[model samples]
Target chain A: MTRYFEDLEPGDVFETSGYTVKKNEIIEFAEQFDPQPFHVDEAAAEDSIFGGLIASGIHTMALASKLTVEETFDMIANLGGRGMDDLQFHQPVRPGDTLHVELEVLETTPSERHSERGYVTYEQRVLDDSDAVVLSLRMETIVRRRPEGQTE
Target chain B: MTRYFEDLEPGDVFETSGYTVKKNEIIEFAEQFDPQPFHVDEAAAEDSIFGGLIASGIHTMALASKLTVEETFDMIANLGGRGMDDLQFHQPVRPGDTLHVELEVLETTPSERHSERGYVTYEQRVLDDSDAVVLSLRMETIVRRRPEGQTE
Candidate 1:
């Protein structure tokens, strides 16, 4: 049985595997979508305002989402989520920057109308090897609750 | 000529052409990346919590980026963005959700080091057919300033 609302508790934390950012991946992702000079060519990036190539913010966010799925895909009974908040690019993540992610359960509450479901809030944080924060996001999602009448 | 940093004043607004969201596009985007049940299968979504298929939030954001690019690609220096803030998914956008985007310049600052470049912030809003806001975002971008030595 999948974990539902009753299984989640405040203060739960999940640590994710880290991944290295490759120069080619960053360049390709930005070229087709972002197309900014700094994100396209390494040499061109040095002359641009950022003074170095940086990973596209979307790529970083997408990686974080993948880590979340890898950790909780089976246990999760996810409904949907509010968009991210307080997203800051603290330091530019270069080609070699390895990103590690963590998610913390912030709050939980039962839905008013749906006794079979509840809502949860989480703090998703991404950090570099030096433990500097790269991005932080807050989200809220709905999850099913184990029904009172059934004990599974 | 493209609008430069010096040309943007607070309250300046730009509206983009409407675009239709196709089912295959949403499904393909979600399946390869997002992989959420509600985003992948219409029938499965109907049996699931959401009651129908929905676009991934990231897909909506990317579409918004496409709209922004179409409107300003040639006009701006395009130094990439600081981050996104105040993102809200007011309603679930299914296939055939025609979307139009609007952006209003909120602030501008000249670059101290780069005489030909500066930064600007805009309040971006996306609405659906009924004029309801489907997404709201705030963005900061870097754009080239008209050359100080030039007389226009």
Candidate 2:
């Protein structure tokens, strides 16, 4: 889905394929990056406030970032990103959790720096199998404008 | 630093030791996660707008997350993050870029849902060797309140 800035309208919603979090993968990612007990030690995590092994927030973010590109977000002309805002983690993502993502276009602004590019801000939500929103944020992306005669 | 919610003042600022980005690490990260052409393929990246290989934004987030725990954030009371807002890729992170991070406490709000915990928002910035901000975000975290008679 190579979409251009001009092709995206505010209020457009894009959904992604489901991704499952595995227990080992959670620990692996945590050990390699986050390394917190709740993330790396299953037994310790069970005794912690989280009640069990939980995926690191960065892992969740990586999944979201990957889905944002795989499901939509025109990659060919995707200039890059400005940043994300108002990020909230509502729930801890556990192993066996199957996650789905939704990206809703919130606003679009023509680029002041380049006529060939513009900024698209989206509200990205990561929902668990139970449809609970585990994570949400407003992500701003730099996407290219459509060139003449190009269709995507 | 064992910081509790009450210990985190809104104006508090913390700096982190640097982490250098490696070319192989960047490719490995992208291969397992993002897998974008510009992120995974060096030759493809050379022809892209970036003009060379670049680290995935998610990779940068992961490094920042690791440093947050290793360098500053109070671990014992550090409940996992809620989410990040206004995450921006201010500059492309290239191989060999030595990155330093700064964390500034933005605000603290006691949790209405749970009296034992509160939310602390930090503005996290990753600056390259040149002192240019490459990535920045507002990260929200849930931290436990100090127990009675606890001293740190």
Candidate 3:
């Protein structure tokens, strides 16, 4: 069932399954997108503040988005993302860490100019196995509205 | 010559070389991190609002970060990213489009608690070959302070 804009209510919550962070994957992503010592070079990371190789924050953000799409947003009438706000990286994600996402619908506003679409704001918290939030952000997306009188 | 916190001043601007966006890379990244049909499937994208496959916003963000790190941040005594705010994607990034980044230092603040480090805030604008701003964000990062009396 496709979830339209009207189907998402503020305070609605969703959880996604876990994804294990791999050392090689982290290095590969970092090399391609970040390439910082703490994220790519294990030996150099030992001397940095992290003390070990860690996943790039960008990688963490991507992982969070992936999980949300696979488990929740894939079923929605999502047009695309509008933007993000208040993006924060709270903890370093290590190679052995397993991560999951908790998504809360924060707001929904029907587009004044477009009758067929609306905006949905969600607070996404990416948490590690220990329940600590590794990353958090507020994401705004454009979603199609259900046709009038259509009950699916 | 590493650029320490003390070396960065507000209004310092750096422009990066361009990166050509490839169709295969876009699909591969979307497949791994954001498997929305519009981002990963070309045929499905034709029917979507965009009318074509588009790079995932997360992928664009990563590309911006990569360009910054490679062209500018690599020479800084950087610790790691703190966070980002006001992230906006103004336009959809298409395959074959080349992208570049412009980073402007916005603020610098010495860490009161950690004297050896401080924070540098920058406004990053990711532009395409047409000179349109596709993505923009405010990024904050921790940077090591220059050692006292070390003028090299």
Identify the candidate with maximal lDDT: 3
lDDT per residue for candidate 3 within B8-83, as digits (tens), equals 9999999999999999999999999999999999999999889999999999999998999998988889999889
Which residue runs of candidate 2 sit more than 4 Å off their true CA positions? A74-76, B74-76
Cα deviation at B26, candidate 2, in Å, is 0.9
Pairs of residues clashing in candidate 3: none
Clashes of 1: 0
Order the candidate numbers by DockQ, best to worst.
3, 2, 1
Screening candidate 1 with a backbone cut-off below 3 angstroms (N, C-alpha, C), the clashing residue pairs are: none
True contacts kept of each: 0.35, 0.75, 0.90
> Worst 10-residue stretch by lDDT in candidate 2 chain A?
A71-80
List candidate 3 stretches off by more than 4 Å: none
* lDDT measured at residue B62 in model 2 versus the true structure, 0 to 100: 90
Sorted on lDDT, highest at the top, how do the candidates line up? 3, 2, 1
> In model 2, how large is the Cα lDDT of residue B12?
90
Q: What DockQ class does candidate 1 belong to?
A: medium
Q: Could you tell me the TM-score of candidate 3? A: 0.98
Docking class of 3: high
True contacts kept of 1: 0.35
lDDT score of residue B128 within candidate 3: 98
Q: Fraction of true contacts reproduced, model 3?
A: 0.90
**TM, every model:** 0.86, 0.90, 0.98
Residue-level lDDT of model 2, residues A1-152, one tens digit each, is 56788888899898998999999999999877888889999888988788999999889988887777776653436776677778788899999999989999899999898888888888999999989999988878778899879876
Best by DockQ: 3
Position B95, candidate 2: lDDT: 95
